[model samples]
Target: MGGATSIKVEVYGYSFDNTDLVARQLQSGMLKDPAFTQVTLSRDEYTPEFQMNFDRTKLALNGLTSTTAATAFSAAMSGSVASYYREDGDEYKIRVRYAPEFRTSVEDLENILVTNAAGQQIRMKDLGEVVETLVPPTIERKDRERLITVTGIVAQGAALSDAVAAANKVISETQMPTGISTVIAGDYEDQQDMFSDLLVLIVLMIIL
Candidate 1:
């Protein structure tokens, strides 16, 4: 009923893997069916990211907390307000951070200094690891829940009702995990709403 494609299926869940798994299953089933073609999942590609996984035990032993370590890492990567300069009754912020050349590579990130509560300077590498990972390039949400879409093209001879029935069959055969749900949206949903409204009008006319 929303601004969805003519043949679109939406899956909603909190876990990325679970959502992807369900989407893939539906896409595969659609491809196998003769009614649908050009089936694809929305999240076909991922973006590379550098993720810092911290060790809480190590941090605790060094009299440091996760917050302290995270603050240091953020300051090094993103400049922080070091001081304020005032001139001519106007104030300016003096931000200090590592130079581009000093923070280009993972090695450089590991070398950034972190001072613990005990006044000990520790290497960032000792407390955590920087791993390269892939994440969804774009995240979509509906009603505050994460959503993924599966789109397909209807075959020339196939009716929209047939395509919807195929999709429903796949959904029925699949076991959805907890906290996950699916909806058949797009043109079919719109058609259903139109039919319901027409039925109501016909009933009112008969009563009158």
Candidate 2:
């Protein structure tokens, strides 16, 4: 029982404009980068369901049914919320999705169920397009342009300043599309502001 005890590494903080680009650069082992023991990239993106609103009337005129379209969508990704199943004295979700083999393509998604008010079945493709795309995660309008931010955490024993510097270099050098720009804002700025305020108070007291 005389083995060395465990060691813990603490990271102070980090700053980054593009978390994904940093991840790729780190993965390529470009800068004696620490092997990220654990990485979690957290960012929100707009899903197809939220971006498009189906026009039921338009579908009906085109011999398409809303029920069929919705059903097809549900069938492909998630089936109607099925009842819960109990196992081992605990309850668990029982989502019924199209078997993986059947739901891989846009064709499969388009072919999903479209039941009519008259109890008729139709194909989703007959009415509208079922396109999956990435819209603005959260539209931020600064001078009338959209923006997205990516953020993540680094493991212990990692130098926060080194990471931030590396991230800034990557951001400045990386090529961005015509309308996109990146910015870094997190705990680092907060700490800097707090310290600056504290310094001002200390200097004022000394002068008095």
RMSD of each: 4.5, 8.8
Across residues 127-167, which tens digit of lDDT does each residue of candidate 2 receive? 66667665535433334433333333433565556556655
Q: State candidate 1's TM-score.
A: 0.71
Q: Give Cα distance to truth, residue 147, candidate 2, Å.
A: 6.8
Model 1 residue 4 CA deviation in Å: 11
Error of 1 at 84 (Å): 9.0
**lDDT per model vs. reference:** 0.85, 0.51
Which residue runs does candidate 2 get wrong by more than 4 Å? 1-58, 61-68, 87-90, 117-119, 135-195
User: Whose TM-score is greatest here?
Assistant: 1
Candidate 1 residue pairs in clash (backbone atoms < 3 Å): none
